[model samples]
Target: MGMMKRLTAALAVATVLGGGLVAANAQEVVLRSADTHPDGYPTVEAVKFMSDVLKKETDGRISIQVFDSHQLGEEKETIEQTKFGVIDLNRVNFAPMNGIVPATIVPCMPYIFTSKENMRSVMDGPIGEDILKAFEPAGYVGLAVYDSGARSFYNSKHPIKTLEDLKGLKFRVIQSDLFVDMVNALGANATPMAYGEVYSGLQTGLIDGAENNWPSYESSKHFEVAKYYSLDQHSQCPEVLMMSKVSWDKLSPEDQTAVRDAAKQSVTKMRELWDAQEEKSRKIVEAAGVEINEVDPAPFVKAMDPIYEKYADTPELKDLVKRIRDTQK
Candidate 1:
């Protein structure tokens, strides 16, 4: 538990000193959740839906107040805030978490997940449960994993039909060494930048392009500047909903169960919204004259061999990668 979390729990208990244990259990608690994505985004809306479930489950005693669109901070900044209990909950991609959590690196690797369906299957099973458990020792209680669809390369320059087209091109990537290495391996120069900064980076020519799912490219309005979108579909890393251990410790066991259950149930809503959002964004971008192309994934997959070898060196990671590969598609 973090110092802030401990202090928060202590303060809550102190306020009802004379009321006994029942009063503490009955105390109304509202947790603060953070998301970089704007309102109506699937991840944001899903958390909102979870809040509704939690309120119903707890008889309105427990609720969540979401702060979306970087209202709190960017992903990297909010992650630290969540850890220290400055933020109660967070929804973040696995890339930003790679350096801090080893298990997250496995899923963030390029070409590791064959398709969205496969990725979801792997993450919703025992393997996913194991990965979720990995968060606890690192200061989070992972609740559920949500879909990010498939990520493809999009740029302001020409369509990347072949590996040769990407050579020497500069691209913005999330703040992760694996992401940097992955971009560099594909024959491009990787510029580490925040998600919020990518739009300006693209418009100002600070970067040639970036990689992300269709919805993100559309929602962030990056598609307006980056006209070429190549469907390499390189990565299918999932998004995670996590609670600060400090905030978690403050909840009674029953309330904790309610939170977990509600979070799990929210995945259904997220996936439905995500599927619809992907289709809608694709249509909008296509209508806007964004050149979208499908590339031969064979060459891209071949390029990732060295990346896999470098990152999945440990026996634990090797086993995890193998299990994910062996999972039924």
Candidate 2:
């Protein structure tokens, strides 16, 4: 927050238009945003769009600089830094955030959302507001939730057509206890590895495969080695736009409104970009010769029952699941 105050004098620029500065003199406040995906990935694109929106919405008084492709550090480390006020902003999956804010894990549960519409209803309404508030106690200010699409499994060994097909396969997962539990519940060896290490792990047979959205499978070029992508559609883990509480507290009320509004507006744009990217990435991977398969989610859902029960370790999480399932568009 102190950082932004020092720049207020330097940015006496005008209205922002056509990606250019126009009229009036305003204080310039530049904040940093971070993402692990490459430049074009939907989450990163959303961050860039949010930066633009922030500049324009605030009349060039505020701007954001984004770091993509893990330029600063891995997800967990940067997440902690954001908590401590070292990092101003972070775009990360809700899966890892469950530990710091339990309400986040409710929507991230496997098979939780019936459709994107259903998800939007939950994330943009009361439930979303509740979770965002829940984040306040954890040293984070939840700005918005971005679509992550669905995470399906792809492997070098074989196609996952059924629950039995998943057994004995080594799959890379985020270093989250919930994900580890979910993978193990499916009878697979959950290999928790860093995102950058996944390719080599798959190539060297250290891991048989991994689960992720279409863009990731194509962008990371994992499809080249792991030729079989199973559409288990296990979870729609949304990405969270988080600002450090320290930074949030530092902002003037007007600046806070600008940043928060910009973040929320970016969600609509991000989803549009995400849908197109998912389709494009899927087609690209298929043309690259990756065999994409679909599975009846019933068995997979049934298999996840225990994990769901395990997840209801607290009253808040239990109520969260019920509310999300009950939410309607």
Candidate 3:
């Protein structure tokens, strides 16, 4: 009888241990993502979509928690954090990465992309793949790219019908030398500032104007302060989704593929959201009585020639620039 009791106890203990092992194997992983845009912004929503895709693809074992509205940090700060693995994922404009990642410089060049479709074609093709590969050496795994509609200048001062209208206006630019030079070349005072500070800068008269997409202008409510928006469509730089190499290296090979696939699928969702948001934001700003104008892009394009020469200093950048321009859109 005692021998029978010992066998039963051993069986019960083995069952409990087996259950614990299964539970350990099924542990959930939630990656933390950061974005400077506010919650429900197209990019933020897209990341949420990515999370859904990841969760479903991984059978609920993997997911993402996004912190938007500078919750983690601004673009520049988040870039560094993501590199160090303090942030698992990041969505940032190409401008901040230009100085650190040479591949990004050409893409951020003024007038480099002729239109949204042109930009999308170049980035969705081989050229874009090359740029994504470049991120690895910079401690990031390039996940996907999203649209940042054509950026144009808007000011609290007056209409910018000509280059003359932009002169002497203190404009807020991302913390990038290219942006500074671009604004200065157009004869405006370029004040390099964080994205979060632009609204307050406009309201307090600290900056005479700033430049961005319609969605940004409306979402940030900058349209209320800077009523004059000129559609020169200066830069069509795309936003990038990135994963920290530190976090990526910790994932299994299968999970890595799942994450990459999920991010890629999220791009389609992002573009759809982006198109609708752009139109919605445009209507919202127009309804708010913001004076919008369309300036001849000839002078604006001409002013960027020197800028192009200055940034495409290396053979690689020049080659990339030529290929992008020559690419059939």
Q: Please name the candidate that would achieve the greatest TM-score relative to the true structure.
A: 1
- In model 1, which regions exceed 4 Å deviation? 1-25, 193-207
**Poorest lDDT segment (10 consecutive residues) of candidate 1:** 17-26
Off by over 4 Å in 3: 1-27, 193-207
Best by lDDT: 1
Question: Could you tell me which residue pairs clash in candidate 1?
Answer: none
- Compose the digit string of candidate 3's lDDT tens values, residues 1-329: 24344334433543564411122355887787889888888899999999999889878998888989986556777787677666789999887888778998888889888789889988989999999999999999998989889999999989999989988899999877888999999999999998889999999999999999988899889998999999988988888999989889888999999999999999999999999989999999999999988888888889988998898999999999999988844
Model 2 over residues 170-267: C-alpha lDDT tens digits? 99998788889999999999999999999999999999999998888998999988999999888887879999898788788988998999999889
* Model 3: per-residue Cα lDDT at residue 120: 90
Score residue 308 of candidate 3 by CA lDDT: 88
The residue pairs that clash in candidate 2, if any, are: 14-23, 15-23
- The lDDT-based order of candidates, best leading, equals 1, 3, 2
What local distance difference test score does each model get?
0.87, 0.83, 0.86
* RMSD (Cα, Å) of model 3: 10.7
TM-score of 2: 0.84
lDDT of 1 by residue, 1-329 (tens): 55455445534543455211122244677788889888998999999999999989878888888889987666777787778776789999987887778998899888987778888888999999999999999999999999888989999989999999999899998777788999999999999998989999999999999999898899899999999999999989888999998788877898899999999999999999999989998999999999989899889889989999999889999999999988843
